[model samples]
Target: MPEGITAECLMENIMEKISDNLPKQKNASFFEDDKSNSMSTQFNRLFGRQKPVHHLLGGGKSADVLLWRDKKISASCLTGATVVWVLFEWLNYNFLTLLSLAIAIGMVAQFAWKTASGMLNRSPSEVPHLVLPEHVFINIGKLVGVEVNRGLNFLQDVACGGNVKQLLGVVLSLWAVAIIGSWCNLLTVVYIGFVAAHTLPVLYERYENEVDGFVSNALDQFQHNYRKLDARVLSRIPTGKFRGKKFE
Candidate 1:
């Protein structure tokens, strides 16, 4: 009657109780057949078949980690896109040209983010489309994407510079641009479009992929741990008593 009693012990007790009521020979065969059948059913339930669609979509539980990951990525992209856009606007000085450029950046950034978001929302059965539509994203969004991507690239190059001098050179160049003429019309539109095409969603996508990977790894660890404990503890009771005589 303990909360954590083993299934084998519980089944043995049940068999003994049944034997007391039934003829001895009948009880032995009955218990043996019940054990075999219960094992067959358990094996089938554990590994024999695929999941139905209704349960996969609407059931309160799912075994697929990808489902959880897609949701997390979608949410992150939406939040990140909005926050980054707002911050870029606030941090950079605004004039008519700058505002126009910012508008262009956002327009492209949102679309880029949306592509990644769509992939995250896609089902496992569906094919993922990593390529973004150029026709849809206009000049302004392209510009924003370019700036962010260039910034990221500049950092990467600085990090991997062959010597300290080169690294310092890269840093100085960036500082000079920021201090002297980042606000000026650098014909930033062309570069922005090119960079946004590659960079914007890619960063968000990578973040999402990392989050999903982390969650998946964690869940796998939990299920592995639980299976080891559960088999020893909960898998031995009579099917009739715990799972009903017939599985529906």
Candidate 2:
């Protein structure tokens, strides 16, 4: 009876021990989950973005079009861009020539409409001439100026920012762009970028978690490799000493 009682007591004690440790094990798992979440957040804030991609892109009609929130509008814009690209590229139409042709066609259509409308005893439709507003041009100039200054600032930062990885990335990107520009005309390059801008952002937003996780993993691996490279080679390179010129 005593042996059997001791065996029961031992079994109860083991159960109690396991019960006692279970919460700690759960807490350890929770801690690991929290750590991983923190790391993911850190990685995602790589460009210091704290807002949604749409908000970062201005959250206006332009953002909607880019992200394709309004499918009809987005599709129309894409269709229009495709038509322009076809006219400019496949049809080999010159910009000035196309403009003149369009104007001529409009004038002829208006003249015919006026003649038919008079015969039909109806009011003729107004002829629409190209009347670009001064304010529109000024607004466009401001936007272009802002973008140009922003680009200049980014280049300056890369040149003197002391972040070797960022500098390397910028250099590689510029080199790649140079190669692409060599292969295609400026309009084709711009059109390709327009298409990518229309597509990539929405996809990233839709698959935010997956994209962030994948990018974080890739970045972590890149940083690990970069650290090794820095340790082995870059760390040994001597920085040049700048000597100031003597005053005359």
Candidate 3:
């Protein structure tokens, strides 16, 4: 009905308003209070007793809701992964082979361009200095060690702090890594993770408020369910005392 406003533009404006209205941040105290209240409610609901085994069979409605909300992104990622898998199978080329071939072609193209430029300008060739394979390997090894140490420190801090939520997250992450590792080689996983790390963060930053709201809501639901389970079972188990000091 408005001038210069197509249906697509109207839809975009509405989506932007929705994203802007979503919650982006909350205080730490609020989270702490919510956690305490959730645990209390869970304990009260279960009468401080173990829940029935049938409870384990319950479906995650909250997760389903979140997935449905982000169905477009999820479907796109799934389709892209399937396409990549099909291409890999048909071409019979592993990650390393593809990477090496790409690098070789890039280098050859750059060298040819440099040579042509020198010939056209009648000047000295501008060949780039290349590092030896041994040096490259050493540098790569150091980088790997640094990343491994950082990952270890993160786990150590989570464990020492005795944060049940973070500990469970780490454990679940390890399980996911194990499953992914079983499905594909380490190089392929690394390549996919590298691309995702670069891409997902940029997209998230662009839609920060909306993404944060979705994540916060999902986490709240997960914590609510987890607290119920914890009260009914996990709280009954005796974990040995942790010796290390907790880090903030």
Indicate which candidate wins on TM-score.
Answer: 2
**Stretches of candidate 1 exceeding 4 Å from the true structure:** 1-143, 181-248
In terms of lDDT, model 2 sits at 0.86
Off by over 4 Å in 2: 1-48, 128-130, 153-169, 241-248
What local distance difference test score does each model get?
Answer: 0.57, 0.86, 0.67
Clashing pairs in 3: none
Which ranges of candidate 3 are over 4 A from the true structure? 1-90, 93-142, 150-169, 242-248
lDDT of 1: 0.57
> Candidate 2 lDDT, tens digit per residue, 1-248?
99999999999999999999999999999999999988669767636467889998899999999999999999998888989999999899999999999989978988999999999999988766678789999999999999998898778766765666677789999999999989999889888988998999999888887887777778889989989998998888655434433332
Two-way TM-score contest, 1 vs 2, winner: 2
Q: Order the candidate numbers by lDDT, best to worst.
A: 2, 3, 1
Residue-wise lDDT of candidate 1 within 1-248, one digit each (tens)?
46446777889899998878678678788999999986655443322324542253444423122234355654555455555545445455456666798889976887777787778995333436579777567876888899998887766655654445456568788798777565643434333443453344344344644544565667779889868865885455333312223212
Which has the greatest lDDT? 2
Flag clash pairs in model 1.
Answer: 104-140, 104-141, 105-140, 105-144, 108-141
Ranking 2 against 3 by lDDT, winner = 2
Candidate 1: count of backbone clashes, pairs at least 3 residues apart or interchain: 5
Q: On a 0 to 100 scale, what is the lDDT of residue 133 in model 3?
A: 77
lDDT of 3: 0.67
